[model samples]
Target: MSELKTIDARNTFCPGPLMELITYMKQASVGDTLELLSTDEGSAGDVPEWINKVGHDLISNEKIDGVWHVKVRKAK
Candidate 1:
């Protein structure tokens, strides 16, 4: 069974949140879902683009209460 991991990157700026997600993603198993929490508005776009570029599955991308919640599943 795949697991869901939440990476809280709130209060960080662009690339910070994305980098944190990448670091965790490298250690995650295939099919595991990663939910990234970021206060940076740019992450909502940056993360999804990276996910697509790297061939991962983007489960959801939304903003709640000024925070961007980007969920992705490891595909490799």
Candidate 2:
């Protein structure tokens, strides 16, 4: 199974979670999956859009316990 890194951005605002995702992506190898948790409502939409813009793949996005869980795979 591939490694999955989790980035906890809960309670953080917009751009914060997005920035964290970008930073982690830089440190992650291609095909690696990342899980970003955030409480910001914008993240649900923002994360996926950013992933697509940067050539990454958004595996899933869901909300649990009022937190947004976004899964992304490094495509490049």
Candidate 3:
């Protein structure tokens, strides 16, 4: 499996995590995956929705305890 760059936004809010993800996206390659760790429940829906809107690939997601582990691939 390919190792992904991770951002731990467990204490952040909805748009915070998404913004960080987008900022990081700028430096990532087309196929590179970003693993976002957030505690905001809204992120489960918000991130994926934004990912689709921005043309990224939502590869997978999981919930561990209370944190959301989301994997997004940079497409553009």
TM-score of every candidate: 0.94, 0.92, 0.88
Task: List model 2 lDDT by residue over 21-41, tens digit each.
Answer: 999999999999999999988
What lDDT tens digits, residue by residue, belong to model 1 across residues 1-76?
8999999999976559999999999999999999999998788888899999999999999999998899999999
How well is each residue in 10-68 modelled by candidate 3, as lDDT tens digits? Answer: 89755588888888899888889999998888889989999999899999988999999
How much lDDT does each candidate structure score?
Answer: 0.93, 0.91, 0.87
Scored by Cα lDDT, where does model 1 land?
0.93
Q: What is the lDDT of residue 28 in candidate 1?
A: 98
Candidate 1: the clashing residue pairs are none
lDDT against true structure, model 2: 0.91
